[model samples]
Target: MPNTASALELDAYLRLSRASLGEWLAAIRKISGCRDMACRLHNGGGPVGALSALESEQGFIVCIYASQGMDLTGCRTSDPVVLVPLGGEPQIARQGGRWQPLGKLIVARPEDRFHLRLPELGRVMIMRPRTDILNNLVNSNAGLPIAECHELIDCYLRRSLFFRDHNHARQMTSELFCRLGRIAREESKSGCDCSGLDRRLLRAVDKIRHEPDWDFNLTELASYAGVSERNLYYLMKRDAGITPYRLYQRNRLTRVRYRLVDCQCMVPHISRYAADEGFSHLGRFAALYREHFGELPSETAQWRRNLLEAESGHSEEPLAAP
Candidate 1:
């Protein structure tokens, strides 16, 4: 595919290729609100023929494929891609980051370029905007705030990566697409103003990100924002689509994930991190960590160690006789 090809041009190629695997085109059409959607499959093998999509306004195009042990270069795009490990493992390279194991629900943002080596048969999904419709939706300065819009984009990308099965995946993707379209339509028509609320929410988010070690209670946060607790909750829910507590948890866990995977923090030491983040009970923290990340805190720490060493060009070392 040419580096400068439009998303529509890419979609055309996918439709005309036989190597296209998985059920995504239909899902894209249903969710994205694109009327003239079409796909063709070319199975003439050698490596599955690449699939791409053109940017549109109504929605984005997504591509899902399963492949065994192939090297992919220039997997980068101007839009984000959500990569999930449907089966087996793959190594992902982005920016200065080394080839780390492709875990479930990895949202690869556009700022980072990507290359991948599928060590075993694996599945991946690529999603991009319907340029025309999206532009229409964001036509006005007040229709969709850039930060809020980016968050929504990131959220949708995350959802697409975790899609477990075709039926469920399709339904969820369609719903998200429609919801996004509705938001755009409403904003375009209403000329709404959310700057004050958006600023407050972003300030709260920044507080959490920078001060993960602070014990942040709702009352204190409300005081900081100079709003009533009820109003704060409403604002957070409206802007972030989650409760304050959950958002705090998400923020902390995001930090924890980074420390585990990038910083190689020890398992026991994680409790200290959690405590600093306001986790009073070790057991509860462990449980929540496992639930959110689908692995024990200890395991994540260990995975980080292994990943770091591999990236540094060191021989694999067994964990100290656990």
Candidate 2:
């Protein structure tokens, strides 16, 4: 049976001081494709500099939290970010008058023009999924509203910076993606704020995402979405730039990628994990993973193993960004 156990705590690499914050900001700037964002800082005492960051890499999601140290007002980003507070009431500027108490989660859409005050020294986890992915998931959410996520958000962020084992991260990433798709589906149902084949494309992807091994033939999938295979093919080509099968294939590779980065002492065999995800062609799977993620599977797993080793020894080496 797969390990379902979990434990949690803080990892020291997450401790960001003012000086370290400067360094982090500088290094992140050097990363190509980093989004342009601007923040005006209002510190209670000195510059509000302490923050804890955890990025669930396989899912392309990030969680950053700040407590009583500083209140960031008039903060804006080009994309939508889900903000879940781990402590007190973190208020966005526009909703200052009626901000709810301890359990409110904010979906900071691009047009929100928001200001956030973090007085409780609470941790906030922000997940940034692709904009088009959000659009697809939103429209086809099958009537599940995003507002219902307050409790789920709390549960998701409870692990903080520490995940007890490798399987924990994989499970969290998969579960989070499903919840995000549901939230987006619910959010899109209410308004015309939209894009991408009106959810058919996203729905197909979501099916594959959650169950990579499910037998979803093209005809069955297309018919399920109330369209013929021919129309479905063109819609995917036009909107997502790929066929439904191709998208499913990619998601399968994603499952394999998660296993590749398992951070455990006795990591599972890469070939076995890949095959369990239905990849019989180990060489082809490795090549595809390399092409997509820019590294071989073994190398990725080793990097994580080394990271934990550094952490256990409390080596002051600069931590690698996920």
Candidate 3:
């Protein structure tokens, strides 16, 4: 069995504190493919910076940079970049537009040129999607409606940053791509407003997603959202397409799926793993799991084992008797 059993572990391709600004810049440039990228640190001459990069299985590279501040320029790349701010005031703009503060997220297309300026202690994530993913999006005419889907993107980013699961990250990136493609094909439009109940709903949803195993109720959730129980329930139904209780159940189910896929042991542990996620009723849990994931927990475990074997260059076929 794999030693790392938990799915909430932080796994990254590269995570370290750069000893010098030059080293930090080099690390950023190396991952971002921005050859001429330059940065002038605002926090005096000597400061160590934090940097981390995680590459999804689909080749999406997400790099996080943090320091006191910096004025960055000279990154003229044709790739589409998704900039998400983690903390402090970080701003970026294209050539023809004024600097725009990082509100929720920013999606820069290929034709745009990014000029970034961070004047305080700021942390931001820069994402570069796989080339084939971009090509497929363009070919399918989805044209990256990710900006309109900021809520979903925000949720994805929150989950990714909080849990730091590569498998979950990869699954989410592909799902986001498919969702954007679907959104582009739709003629009608509907979305969540960032103000009022919708925003509160998102907060409650985030809490549930972050701590899915917690026994949360309507009163507690309403208090968390700073709204009345009626409003919270109404908003959760309208914005998230599910009631709060169902949302919690779904998140718990999703976690079970991740654990099943990540664990390398055999299928008999499915019931135990399901029980670990607070599902005491084994048969009902199995039914819900199958309905949610389109496969049984046992099947998922078997699939994971097969995948690992394939990746390790092992075979199921037996050798001839000698």
Deviating ranges (above 4 Å) for candidate 3: 1-14, 96-98, 109-111, 135-148, 161-165, 184-322
Whole-model lDDT, model 1: 0.49
Candidate 2 C-alpha lDDT tens digits along 174-251: 566556665555542222212324477666655665665687599988876667899888877776556677666655
Q: What C-alpha lDDT values do all the predictions have? A: 0.49, 0.50, 0.59
- Measured on C-alpha atoms, candidate 2 has an lDDT of 0.50
| Candidate 3 clash pair list | none
- Minimum summed lDDT over a 10-residue window in model 3 is located at 3-12
lDDT of 3 at 265: 55
lDDT for model 3: 0.59
lDDT of 1 by residue, 1-322 (tens): 2211111122211221222222223223333233233332232233332233223333345443433345555455554544544335756788857888875445465566666655423445444435544454445345444444444544654333223223333455455555555555654222233334466666676676567567768888887777789988898777655677766775576555444433333334877777766677989988877665445667756644553454455745633211
| Superposition error at 245 for model 2 (Å) | 1.8
Q: Work out the TM-score per prediction.
A: 0.41, 0.45, 0.48
Off by over 4 Å in 1: 1-197, 265-268, 309-322
For model 2 the local lDDT of residue 223 reads 77
lDDT of 3 at 257: 66
